[model samples]
Structures are given as structure tokens and as C-alpha cells.
Target: MNSTRFTPADAAELYGIHNWSSGYFRVSDKGEVEVTPGPGLNAVLPDIVDEIVARGESLPVILRFPQVLAGRVRQLNEAFRTAMREYDYQGRYQGVFPIKVNQRRMVVETIASAGYEYAHGLEAGSKAELALCLAQNLHPDALLCCNGFKDDGFIKLALWGRSLGKNVVITLEKFSELERVLKVARQLGIRPAIGVRFKLNARGSGQWEESGGDQAKFGLNAGELLQVVERLRQEDMLDALVMLHTHIGSQITDIRRIKVAVREATQVYSDLVDEGAQVKYLNVGGGLGVDYDGSKTTFYASANYTLAEYAADVVYTVQEVCKSNEVRQPTIVSESGRALTAHHAVLVVPVIDVTGPTRGLQSIPEAAEDQHQIVKDLEEILANINTRNYREMYNDAVGDKETLHNLFNLGYLTLRDRARGEALFNAILQKLAKLVAGLAYVPDELEDLPKVLADKYICNFSLFQSLPDNWAIQALFPVTPLDRLDERPTRQGTLVDITCDSDGKIEKFIDLRDVKATLPLHDPGTRPYYLGIFLMGAYQDVLGSAHNLFGKVNEAHVTARPGGKHLVELFVRGQKARRLIESMGYEEDMLRGSIRAQVDRARAAGRLDDTQTVELEEDYGEELLGYTYLEYEE
Candidate 1:
């Protein structure tokens, strides 16, 4: 046992739970992770998971908190309102949720309903999203922001939405899109609400910075924007332009960049209003960042500013710019999708097994006189391992391990002998790691001793299907145990998901100060271990691929109940094996016939009897009907 007993606080510190969780989660006294989606609402995550598992649900399930989603919508709206009040701004603030962020029906409906009081609308970046937006029961006054490239059909659909009494603002992505929008509106015999996406000189600071600025694929340059204004004026539709839109980026890490973008957009908006266009809204598209790592610094995974700071800067900067330009302040519009949705979903998986250098090593006996020379050398190294000679022993172990592999390759050592040598080497490395930990100044070669001996936890989830951001963009969502947090974690580990791809592993983890290669974890000897990956409700949900045909994981819609309780109002099972194969161009009936034909051929060749053929056919049918993920006995 460790000299110091672990408490929930220690576990919290170890996992940096507070740093990245954003107060939605906390370590309880019972060592369980508790989620508080709203005030006076609390639910232990493990308890909820247990109840779910009892109902015969599998691991790698998504837990969606509608309260968190609603709370985020309300929080952002209130923040902007408070900032506008404090700054004495003239215009109101209205936000729109971008359906491209999550795009699920439930997520879209939740945000729309939650922000109804604020008249929050939806933004669509594609034709498919535009069609979905047209069907929604959005507030009559809410603005349905039509962004992205548009064709004739896309424009007609958006314009038709206007005929239905929708506040549809079709923001032109490029200068050419305006003609098509106007043409469609003329065909419908209704003047369309128009907006222009302005390409700004100021670029945001983050991975998505290139997606904005003058060189961006979307939006119109200043020169092109001027052309659009002159064209709209000639068409006698200058007053139809109701909004000026600019995108800095998504997940912007610095506050200064946001203020700069706001200044540039406000200047453009004021100029547009002066140019005889009735621009009443300034759209700062989707760049309010979420702090994935809790340091609150300017790191890429975090934001240096708070929600209050973001709101204050945006409202005040626009106010200052508009006042200087001698124009009335426009209604501030923001499409903050990441921060609104990132903390509402979590992926819960189980640690099915653990693999390490010293996991199953048995006690080594004295080296026999007739043992291989490499075996004797390993035994000698382990016997004399001490604080003073630990560094030298580590070096010797590394060299010996190489020689051991060579000897086994040359067929000089048996499997048992190789196992013994490997076990002895791991044991020496463990002792050296302990010695190196206590050293004030360690040699450079020995610094990696701890990491080299770290365990690999085989978690039961597909990284491609469940948590793709970790694999795609090096996204760092918080990973921690669901229970046993009161006890100290003795193992340092990295997670390996159950994907056939060699890249299906999460080695980089978020740290307050730096990126970590391993996470502190408790050992799961004979018990089932569970882990929760937090802050994955944003891009991770819809951006995942069906790589390896793993399909989507199960989903549980966790809604807050009366008296501080929570319940899973909806449960969605994962994809079955049959469906996955069918998607790969294999029909079920055809597959069944083909498989039966193979069985008949085998039996005709005398390879199987009738009884054996029946058993094999039944087994093959069962596999096609089962889940793609591995199953275990309850």
C-alpha cells in the first residue's frame, strides 16, 4: 500500500478534474464522479451507469445531459445580456445554434427550445442543414441564419422559408451567391433578407485560424464585398441586406484575437450601414472557445478568457467601434456552438484488460548453472539492483533485452526461457524507476524509465466510432475512473481502444501545464474498471467515422428529474453486426445463402457431418445477429 491514503481531493488533483470539467463534474466523498448539470441537480455518474448496465446495456455508451445543453444556452444568453447592460449598449443580443456542430435532432431541438425566450435561432452551413432548419418550429422572431455556399435550390429553400413567415437571413458566402439568392427570391415574388460574410484581415489564433481571414475559401473579400453592395444597389435591394457576418475561427484560444475580430467586423458593419444598406446585425460566427484543459491559459486546448470576459469584450468592443463610426449599434449575433455543446456529452467505457512489462511476472529463482548466459546475466542484474547502481542496471537491462530478442530470433532460446528473461528485465526496470523517482538530478538516459514501464489499458471502445477527435485532431478530452477515486492510483497508463487499426490509441492526454503521455489509474485485478471521457459533446459526436465497421456506440439521454435526481429517458442501442456488413454491400439473405453453400460444399467433401454442419450454421447465424463490439458474461 502507498504511505499516504488517497482521498477524493487527491483523485481530483491527479485527474485535473476541475481544470477541464468546467464545474459540471466533481469527485464526491464516496469516490464517485458526480455531475451537476444545473443548480439543485446532482447525479453520480457511476450510479447511473450501473443502473444502465443492469438493464443489459453495453459499455462505450454516450450519456447526454439535456440540462447541461439547456444551461449552456441560458448561460451564454445571460452573459451577453449582462455584458450589454453593463456596457450600456443600445442593441440586443440574439444567438443562433449551428446545427453542423452536433446536427442530431435531439441536440438541435434542445438548444432551440432552451433559447426560445431569447429568440435563439439555428444556423445552417449546408443544403442538408437548410432543409432541416426549414422544418423546425423556430420562434417567429428568431433568425434562421443561412450560411455556407448556396446553389439555386439551396437559395429557393431558404427563400421559401421566408414565405412561411421565418426570419431567414441568407448570408452570402461569396459575391456570386447573392445573384442566385436574389434570383430565387424574385421567382418566389418575395424580397429575401440578405447578409454578406465579410472576409476580415484579422485572423484568429488557433488550429481553425486559416479557415477565416482574407484567404479563406468562403466569404467575400473587401473588394468583392463592395461589388456586391453596388450590385444590390442597382437591383434596388440594398435595404434587403440585414446582416454583416464575419468568422474569426472556432475554438479561439486568445481573447485579444476575438476583440480584434469584433473591431474589424464592427467597422465593416458601420461602413455597410453608411453605404445605404440596412445592416441591423453583426454576426461573429462561432469562435467562442471552450477550455478543454482547465489551466485557463492561452493554450490551444484552453481559453485565456472566461465567458464573462468574452461577452464583455464582444459587447464593449462593438459598442466602442460603432460609437466611433457614428452609427447606431447593431444587434450582436454569435454562433457559439463549441462551448455550448462540448460539456454535455460523455463516453463511458470499461477497461477490459491491462498489459504491461511486469503485469504477470512471477518470482524469479536463483539462476541455474545450466541456464542460458543471457538468463544468468538478467538474474545477476536484478540481484544487485540498488539506489547507487540503478542507473547502470537500467542500461544493462535495455542492452540485455535487445540481446534476448536477438537470441530468440536466432532460435537459441526457448519460449519459456525468453519469458523468464523478459520478466527479469521488467522487474529490474521497475526497481530502477522507483530509484529514479527519488533522485533530485537524474541522468538523461534514465528519465524515461517510468514511462517505459507504464501499463497499456485495453479499453472496450472504438476510437474511430466513439472518440474520433482524439484520433483525428489530437483533441484532449478528460479521462478518469468512474469509481475507486478515493483510493490512490498505482499505475500509469495509456488507453488502447478496440480498433483493428494500429493508430487506435490515446497516448496524449491533457495536463494543466503540459501534455501527458500517461494517466494515473488504479489497478483492476479481477474487477471491472470503468472510465469516462468528458467534454466530448461538440465535434466528437457527429465527426466520428465508421472505421473498422464498429458503428456508433449506445446512447443514454440523461435528463434531470425532480428532487435532484436524474433518469435516462431514452436508450439507443449500437449497430448490430448484420447491419454493419449490409452497409458494406453484403446483403443478409445473399450472405446467408452463400454461407450455407460453403457449408454444403464442406459436408459434400466429407469435412463435416450433418450434426457438425447444423452447429456451425447456427453459430454463423448468431454472429451475424450480434453486436459488433465484444461481449462478456454478466
Candidate 2:
């Protein structure tokens, strides 16, 4: 009998998640986590996961749900289209996927394929990314936005794209860039549509607030913008200036700030049009945020408004400004990379262990005769009367702890006595705090203490390699165990990655006080604990590095079929030892041969027996085929 009670097979039947897909987590009929099945298993997850594991894959792997990506594209398009229609907005809304967010070929291809209907396009910030966008063979009508600082090569590539009949818009970040674009366009004999990135006086709120305002690195100031227009006019290339672009920042939280930024940009559009700049589009650079916490409240990395609300605001605000200026409504373009891609991928990691507070005395032992009075005082405090006396009792217990510490320091008590006193005092305080919590009068610091004391699960995944934004900028992503969503999570624990670096631990978590310094995880013993880090599809992939040589995790794409069956396809396996070695500039074949020669020499010298040699060779072979480190299993 298969000892696995819940498998990926079960997850597919219930959760509607399919393999080869990159989004949704397939929950089993019995409420378990697994890859959604493919057509072979009627697209059930348990069978897929079992098959993969049978092939020697591990428990912790990333399952990509492609349907989620398709769905997100559809949702975004429908939202903007609806807003445009409802408001009778004259200009259409077009979206572009920023390449800097995620440059993976599969991800970009998927977005390009799914977004064909909406004239959705790709945005590139670098030459390589521009090449990828150009190679995508995007829909003929789609816009191809080229951003970031430009060199001769980058401008040449954009102009070349235009020569191929691609709707390439080269956004000028600096005034000098226009000179380069002109040079490139003239050489290529292709007048590519030009866009000027305007640095606005308005500032947005959140982590990316600096992406706008006076200090913003990108975009031209008012004087620079005027100079660019004059230069373009002098060269008779003014008509090529078709788009006015401005990006306040990524993950903008406040809707009001966006309104301000848009209003200001809209006025700029009017001013440019009034000056005969021939502006046809207002490209609001990507700032759409994700609701990582599910709180629906604005956070540093989240937006205050929904997609519909955001689209409506942009359309209405732009229309009002355009009507007032008597200029035709310009087409609205948004490089909303985060909101579009954030929900498309989920990073699933497994819990390896649960750590607890260090062991100590439970009650005041018989050794503490001199500190007996202190223990008695703690007990009295623990048996407090009511809220009226709770503060007074807490103060008394604190004083007693200090007195006991002083006694121990003065050599009046032994280490054992001090330990007993500390344990008793802590126990008493815990009890009192629990009582106060019941009455809803617990101190702010003590609010989460009870939960913290309950459990501390140590997960097996690298925070830096997986969620760099969370570690670097304190960006919070939704993290919940892939399995056991049905059961309440009781343990509040900091996640510890496999890296030896001290910074690898995730202590700050999303909470009311702050984004979680740590997360509340379930005990691993009860089940195979796996956590899903959601809304990380954007930026995380490209930004991730092999810190400590921990390469990417095993990845599979999941897709939902029209019928009930789900399709789970293994898109890419995690990095193999050979691949990692090659990346680090070591030839895998040479390294293997050298190691084998060493082993053979050892065996010839009688330093290793035949059995040991065979075992060592087999282990080494396995290492070459598997991920960087052997996942430690308890």
C-alpha cells in the first residue's frame, strides 16, 4: 500500500491546479498540497508528484501554474477595457511587461502569448532584454517599449526592431539619449517612435517613492524636456516623439499618490501637445502593487486600489485633463510588471525542523533556598486578582527578577539557584500574560509572545536566493504552508535557510506592527510541511543570485485543461552539480575525471576498500545529478 495518504494526485482532483502551470496551488480532495495532475493522470497532482519523486526528485520544488499567468493577463486587459468603456474614454489602454521584473524565456514567452489579444507588449531595460523582446515575434499590433540608459548598441537594436516593422518605442531617459536615437534611427533608415521620460515634481509613496521626484535617476527635468523637443524640432524629428513616459516607482502603495503623479503627467502631456510635440501616448511606467498580506490595506510593497479602480482612475483623470486642454485623449500605456507577473509564480519550500527555546528548570528547585522569597513573589504575581492589579503584579515580578539577578551577581547564590529563579519568574510572567491576553489587556510586546512560545519551525530554503526583496528591502510576500491550510497554524517561527550566513534567517515578518519579522508555521512532524511564497513572480527571478552556490530550485509548469483534467509538465529541473560547476568556471567533465582519478589512486594505495569506493562513487554521481546541497531530512 502506498504509505503517502495525500499525494499530488489528490491535489489535482480538488484544487483544479494543472501541471506546466505557474500559478495556483492544487490542494488535494483531502486538503493536501501537490502538483495538479496532467492529462495522463486526468491531470491530478498526486500522481504527478509521485511520478517525479519516483524519478528521485525531492519534496521542496517550485510548481508553476501557467493558467494563473493567462488569467492575470485576461484580468488586467478586461479591467482596463471595462474602465475605458464605462467612462466612454476615447483612448485605449495598453500594457507592457517590464523585462527587468522577470527575464526568464518561458515567463516572457508565456506573457507574450497570453497577452496577444490586448496589444500587450514587452519592455526592455538592457540590450540583452531588448534582444529577447525582439526575438519574441510579438503580435504585429503590440507595442515594444525600450527603457533604461541607452548606449549606441541599445539604440541601434531598438531602431533595428522598428525597421522590422515592430512598434518599437525608445524612451529617452536622458536628454543626450535623443541625440543617440537620432543618430541610430538615421543610420538604420527607420524612424522609431520616440518617448521622453519626464521626471515629475510629484512623489509617490512606498518603497519605490524614490523612483520619481527630483532625485529620480531616470527621466528628464522640465528644462531638459524642453531642450529635447527643441533639438528634435531642429532635426525635423519632432513628430517621432509619440509617447510621454513617467514612472514614480515600483509597488506604489497609495492610490492618492498615483493620482497626483498621473495628474501631473497628464498636464505634461497637455503641455507637450500644446507645444506641438505630437504626443500620442502617455506611458505611465510600472507602479501597480500586489496585496501580499491579503489585508487589502496599502503597504510599502502593496497598492491601495484594485486593478479596476486603478484603471478607472487613470482613464478618468487623463480624460478630464485632456478635455480641459482641448487635446485628443492620448492612448494610455502602463508598464505594470509587478501586478501582472507577481501572482503568476509561487515558490514552495519545505520545513526541515522546529526549534524551541533552550531547556531550563521548570520550577524553583530545592537548591534555591536564599531566592525562595523571590520565587514565592513570582507565584503570587502569577495568581493575580484582576485587571486592576495586573500591572502592579507584573511590576512586582520584574523587581523580584532584578533582585534575584543582583543576588547571583554578588555571589550570594549559585548558578543553579539563578537558573531556577529565572525559570520560575519566566513561567509566572507567561501565566500572567496569558491571563491578561484573555482579558484583551496584554501589553503590545507580549501580544505575540504566546504564539511565539508555541512553535518555531525551521524551513529549508534560501531567503536571499528565493525572495531577495524580502531580505534586501523588507518587502513582504505572502507565505503560507502549501499543505495544512485546513488546519490552523499554531507555531510562530523565524525561517532559517540552509546558508551558513547569519543574514539568511528571516526574522522580520508581516504583522500589524510591521511586515512579519517571522512567520507562524505548522509543526513538521504532523505532516510534510511545505510553505508557498506567493506574489514573487516579478523581479525575484532575475534579481536572484546563487548565494552560497544554492542555485534555483526544481521547477514544473502546471496548466489547467478545458476538461476537468490538469496538465503538470516538468518545464525545468533545478540546477545540476555540473551546471553549477560550469557556471563557477570549472569544467564538469574535467572535475569529475579528476575526482575519479583521485578515488582510483586511493583504492590502489589501499586507502579505500572496494565497497567504500563504490559507495563514494555512487554518492558523488548522485551529487552531480542533484541540487547543490543534500536536503537534510530528520
What is the Cα-based lDDT of residue 504 in candidate 1?
Answer: 95
Residue 314 of model 2, lDDT score: 88
lDDT of each: 0.87, 0.75
Candidate 1 clashing pairs, residues 3+ apart or interchain: 19-294
lDDT of 1 by residue, 52-143 (tens): 88998787788999989999999999999999999999999999999888987779989989999999999998889998988888889899
Predicted candidate 2 versus true structure: per-residue lDDT over 405-481, tens digit per residue: 89878987678777767766666655654567667456774566554454455666777778888779877766655
TM-score for each of the candidates: 0.96, 0.84
In model 1, which runs have C-alpha deviations exceeding 4 angstroms? Answer: 1-3, 360-369, 562-564, 603-615
